[model samples]
Target: MTNELELKQWYQLLFGKIDSALLELKDYDGNYYWDSVDPNSLRYFVSNIVGTPWQNHMGLSLLSVTDRKLSPQSIYNLMSTINARLKNLFAAAELSEMVEFNYSVVEKYLTGSLMPDHTDRQRQSFLTAYGSFIFNVSKWITTQFTNEQQSYFSKFLFPKLPFDNRDFSVRTKALDVAKETRKTETSAVTPQLPEIRAESHFRWNQVHRLRKAMRDVLEKARHDRITLPLEFSYDESEYTNERWHFVLWDKESFGRYYKVGTSSENEVFLEFVRAENLDDGRPGDGLWFLEILRLRLIGIWDQEYLEDNERLKIVEYLNQWGYEDAVQGQAPFQIRNPGLLTQSVFIVRNSRKFDKLLINLEPIYVACTFARFALDIITSSGARMNELLQISYDKNCCIVTVDNSVTPPSKNYIYRLIPKGREEEENYYMPEEVYRFMSDIVNLLKESYNSSSIPEVEYSAATRKHLMSKKRYIFQYKGRHINEFTINAIIRFLLHGTIIQTSEGNQVVLKAHLLRHAFATHAVQTEKIPIDIVKSLLHQKDISVTEYYSAPTHQQISDTVG
Candidate 1:
């Protein structure tokens, strides 16, 4: 028997603040709703009833009854019975058993007498909500019990509710009744390439415009057309500290400024920049500022405008600012190749300066490039976003295998990826175009680093238990590997202003995972590939999952019905 004191504690935890005969409930938004639910009565409404105000109220009014009323022991016994019935239903091997349990056990607590005036739909809704509430409560109650006590209440130990609280028979019956309705309803379609292509073009165009604006600003600064406070020169008359205010680009009405100075000023500048760029919501304006700053310093050094002492002072400042490779006589850019200027030596050397920098353009630039490359790979190969992001250069991530058995020699481009939730690596087939793209990116990285092979760094994959030391990850910027958040941000930034409407006329938000879905849909629907083949390509364990991607759209449904 369950202890009365413990049951009372559990009751308090489950339902908060029951004053008099009223039971107080809080919605997700923290708003309270009081119902005429009697805690002392033999009958009690089910806990955690969710729906609209009226629906919840109605559901709560329909009580779960037993011979003995409102004691902790009686309530516990009723909940245990419900838990046992649910376990039996979930564990039933045959559909007949499930159907029998539904009628015998489920309908017992949620009897027709409780809602005599309500329709069949209303009764069914209450039944569904009651089952869910009991299941959740049972799970919670099990957590409070000891291991031995849990074993005694075996049903609550691992309570598995059927999908959507509907058994096979219920689903079959529902489908039979709604067959005509489903015919009229349009199934969801995966994202199309044309829409994604348009969005990609928009993003690239924005990047180009930003680059051009940056160059124009740099040219003006170089020629002394506009004065930029690149150095720390205090203005005593104006009572202003030495600061660098970089104006990269500006709209007709409002201008975008990147301010690099003290920590306090950077905070204020960031808010200002956010306000200025609030229209598009694009990130990395601070990164653009840093890039332009690096470029201007290089231009100044190359032009020999500053005297010996002035140049030495600039070098000292660069060293202090955490540019580790900044030598006494050499220019900041000349310390390393311009392409390699934004490497770890520049960014991660000083932790304080890095934090104040707000963002890095190199990572954003690298993320953008990888995202572009990944768009082709994901759409073509049906690779998961994480699988592509976790590819390591040291592991021979991409390989070309030739088949001699065929009449003509065929080359297969295989990308080895650690699939999500699996420790063992899997091979993903790719097109020659994708292979060439990967090669080009690899070559570019090698060139930038001025090395024969891509530099090896420590990488940690989501599936792995430990960090992979000395692995050259292809999807990396500087010393850091680009993450899903950065990639998603870049996708959103690129898709800005490019509108793709849904069948219901709502605007569609593009994501990287949606591209994988698009690839699957295109393979099965557009290419007329076999379901098994599509499933294999998508690396899906179940064929049914793959079929979901190829579901007919509204237009297809309309045409078929016509």
Candidate 2:
């Protein structure tokens, strides 16, 4: 048998340590006391009724209950016996009033065990968890009660009781108050700062010209063995053949012609033939400039330019020069060299200052271009990074299919890219911008890998085989597959200064998941796409999953009503 004072001390030891731990939890710490640093931020080490699996170790140290002296089993048995009696009383309650009364008794015992110095947050948490626990346990006890026993208990528990007033929602109300208090404190300490403006797309505008930039970097990489931060190294190319390198048109005559072909050497010249001479193989009079005007750029490409109007003006200039015009006299119109497009754009945007400064595009700049492309695809498509990475050069497309049959697990199938970890393959069509950039990357990879100008490797067959297999994955770094961690790192580096202030005025890192939400929300709420289609695009098994992603734009509650 245990003394009353000893029992009370034991209860204090258990609940006191728990309260202390709860108070110690810091929201801004690198690691939270009760939470894990994962997507869910799941509460660990502590919960409403018990602690984590490792609680026994904590209990032993706190209680100082050694096996040589006090029996831990005896204390556990005593608590279990008390709990059994409480369960009996719980099972006997039939009426809501009786249930609430029994719950109050349990609450008194639990609250009595808490230390007097408990923090407000810890107190509120305890109350909320206690209420929730009572509500759950009452449900279990209600199931076991006989009709007659329940009636007896209910009648006695509420024997001609006078009208009473007690708010069961007090715990919830206290939580709201606690949250407001915390928010006010946080906001006062860290007021909202000015928004950080994004870097100009001057570099992104050079994506088309990035091919030359990459080659320049590779050439520089050869001479100096300059170590780039991304640790992966490029293998030596086959030096016996001259396949790796391509000759560039002189900067002076860069825009003389445009060539499109499957291979670098054998390009099919898209000649401008007059409508009357369409069937003939002969080229029309120096009408090559007409083809330049007909080139339709993807919408995203134009965004790389600082201003839409400026890009539009450039397009207009190219199109404004047709020979069919009534103005017969032709003036000498200077053709801007494509090689100096970036410099030309800079000059035009800078009030035609006639600045002769040349922009040297580095290798890091080329790598960032790929990173931006990856970000674009993931954000626009609402596809998982893994799913997007599964897209092989030849198999890139986007098509969604729906199956209604119950057998074989019915689901909406997104066709085109084969899903990672699934055996099934489907046909789909991707957005044009994605297709174009991804195809360009494929060509770039082929050129880099098969280039004869690079020396052949002196590595083992296993290493060679591994490098060859890396071709299967779209995102490769120096013959190795670039994983999700590297992609996220690249994104973080690119968006270093970006920040978003919360209602509490706390600034948080802009995560990739935010971009995922941006895609879904834009599709469902902004673009007003059908909810079912949104679900299909997101690859969510249930419509409810998409609802979280498509929360409505915030507005005052009063404004929402008439």
Candidate 3:
């Protein structure tokens, strides 16, 4: 019954008109205009152009289309308007028979083959709105409508769409490369051995010679214009050869050669040779070797074997690819061991524990004071580590609403981190304790620096570097602004002895999150705060996370029995 000619003509006409409209939206910069235009005119224009039941049926009439708009917001508003109309149409009618008809139009519009090319954000917005519409209408028709309607909705409307509804299950995969490496078996040719060996001194001396030889070999290869797969046979009489076999590769395949055992000699060879390739023969093997080389260089520098200028040159060369921390005194390659801090046990007890620690560690009063202040903020405000670091004093004590033009404005939290349009802010209300702490810190910083406006330091996205200001930080250690890593380290050090053994027989290391968990638990369980309130405080997306915190504790059970 459908006319192919008319369908083609209709698409052609709509495409031309929409393309013109999009052109009209171009601003002075040639970017799509985002200013408010007449939404009514736009809707009227679209409806008149489409010239079919598709307009009315999809609720093009109900669109609260704004006049002035930019790329994503413009597209989002249009889809939202269409979805609203679709909801009402599906709710009122028993269009069980028209499932295919409706879907064909939706699919065509969503594909936007005729529409002007738009940004990823615009595309995502359109897809999200369309996806939401399909899900909501399908559910309504199946549940509230007749049996025929349900069958049509379930069979045609739901299954035909090649996307998931919000109700579908999500599978998450945990892939930690480092953790997997620990469990992976070493090649038979390369046996794993303890890092520290009995012949560590002798091995280190051999390693130094090997390092120089490897560098010299690389330099010679560069001079000879030889590519990465360099070739040279080492004679058994190359050195004293006391440790193990002193030979290189066989000539035929030029295959990688190594000793069969897990001795210091093998380790040094493997560390140097394996740096060129992993066992599976992947590239980027040089990185591991480079790390080892840099560490050895640092050790040599630290032992004062190298002059200050020479040490500086070595550091600069190593840091050329951004391994500044590793080349420094910090052990960047150290594996993260799981902590033993538990939630309920630490929170109620840490306050007293921290107080005692402050007294004991009095020589470092600045670090201790900063820790205490940070602890108060985390416990009372429930801000995440990043959010806490980003917080700045505005000097405005009165509750104020934050209006973000790109997103919905919020009045939830007076003290909040306002990021750019791409991310959302979790506005939270500061409690009396947090407010007092802020006041005290602000006054202290003002008196110390003799300035009201304290400039906080944070990393810049453009250059990927930390930029600090001359003014003091609200939370600082040794006169430097405190970062998440520093704060976490401090928290661990403060609660080093505290341990919490879980029911699963695993130890939970006490971290800053333990304090957050404690705060959430106390707020939701003991204080009986609303889960929604808890979510806002914690800046969490769902009540489920807060529920985990509020789960009935062992103490609650014991008290109930008593």
Candidate 4:
């Protein structure tokens, strides 16, 4: 939770009109964008915190941008000399200016491709982690600093050069006011509203997008050999304007026709038909039916989902059992081996082969599978691990309970897990491995950790917020902060191990996320799965994130044209 006091720092910084100091992060139209410093200053700002040697590089780049020290070409050449070529890492002043010049351009520029959904439970968990106070302070400060005319507290809190040591009282008052102002500003901002319209649920400008979504659906329909109606009714009801219901008729099934409708506007075409249409006693229902239609039009559903879902079903079912062997040993992981968790996953997976199908090991398979499934759910769900662990297996379907830490600390986040492809499943669904992993975690936590005799510590909303704080570094490796250097090092190592050839003749080394990226990029490039499925797998709220990661690696892109 970002307290009023915490937000004051950046608020004071901006009020002071200082460029080189720290700034807080803020939500700009549902996304976070930091502003307030000059182009040169911004480089130093980011460099000091994000990268160590930013000043010299920026100074050199500054000379290059202006063509004073070297030709622009020479600057580019000089930049190329750097060993780790960072894309979108070094932002020039003009590019930053262009970001504000047009909002849509800014829309295209999202780091992490993450949207700040204040209302989203998972996002709230994250916001609490990153500290709303500092973020708000930073945003306000950036705005105040960037403008030609500085804001109210500039003269007092942040006096210009030739300052005296005796005037502490005046500066402190100004700082207090700045913090108050930020508290007002952040509290004033609201969450993004659901885009709903008569034509489609999205904004009007998304007509092209609707067409694309339809193209995917029609293709699926044709594949199932399921002919679709001329027009579908989505949210024909008075209250809900976004629910989409497609009047699809499968010629192959006994029901002969399934009016596939999705209450969820963002619902994929496959998920749309899968939900109610599952167990409708029709021959070849569910994903099997959807795939037949999809394949008929697009030629493939990749059957990746079938493997994943089969895994999910086993996991989810095992999660229902609430079982695990008593863990008598020490933690399977050591602080020295963070990647050990990743490696251990494969080891555990291969330990028991899937060959013993329809047997006692099925329960164990389900347990392990759901553990992995739970892990995937949190990653893709974008929720804190603890909040994700709070998912109630007691519920008919695993439903995640979200308790907000800051702002309205009393309110908990409530959301149902949504499954992909198979609409016949729960509202919110977990992948198979997550359920298995979570189940294992439950057993592991039970015997290993002392619950009743555990040392006392506050587990209130405040403490929860502290645990969830982004700065606290849950993903942090031992003796390593979750900063750029470590992240870059990991990516570099992963890249050195893998390589991809793009269509444009660029040979790019594959990074850690490259496989996940491949899952997304290959899906769209191949035109195999619908765009929605690709987005779901990638956990994108909008296509922009999809657009960034969805680009095929060199080889896949090259192979398409070849």
Give the best candidate by lDDT.
1
Per model, how many backbone clashes are there? 2, 13, 15, 50
Please report how far candidate 4 places residue 100 from its true position, in Å: 27
Please write out the lDDT profile of model 4 over residues 164-247, one tens digit for every residue: 212223334444565443322211110100110111111211222333455566677678865544244332223322334333
**Which portions of model 3 miss their true places by more than 4 Å?**
1-363, 396-414, 418-427, 443-453, 459-473, 476-480, 499-508, 553-562
lDDT of each: 0.47, 0.38, 0.40, 0.31
How close to the true structure is residue 139 of candidate 2, measured as C-alpha lDDT? 47
The residue-by-residue lDDT of candidate 2 on 62-144, one tens digit each, is 12212112232323332233333333334443222332544454443334332433344443444443333333334422453
Residue-wise C-alpha lDDT for candidate 1, range 1-562, written one tens digit per residue:
2254235532454343222122332333543323222332213333432221222222222232211123333343434444333444334423232223344444432343332443444334434544545555455434444666445444312223444435434434444555322322212324346556545544444444444444555566569865442222111111111122232322211122323223221211111122123334333232223432333343224344546765566666555433434553434232211322233332322222333332234433444456567776777788887778766665477678999999799999888877755666789988797677677678768866788888766553322313234567786655555555555545544443344555555444456776666677667666789989888888888788777755555666566699
lDDT of 1 at 543: 80
Question: Judged by TM-score relative to the true structure, which candidate is superior, 1 or 3?
Answer: 1
TM-score of 2: 0.35
Which should have the higher lDDT, number 2 or number 3? 3
- Judge candidate 2 at residue 442 and give its lDDT: 64
Residue 368, model 3, lDDT: 33
**Considering only N, C-alpha and C atoms within 3 Å, which residue pairs clash in candidate 1?**
42-69, 42-70
Candidate 1 runs further than 4 Å off: 1-191, 205-364, 403-410, 439-470, 560-562
Better of 1 and 4 by lDDT: 1
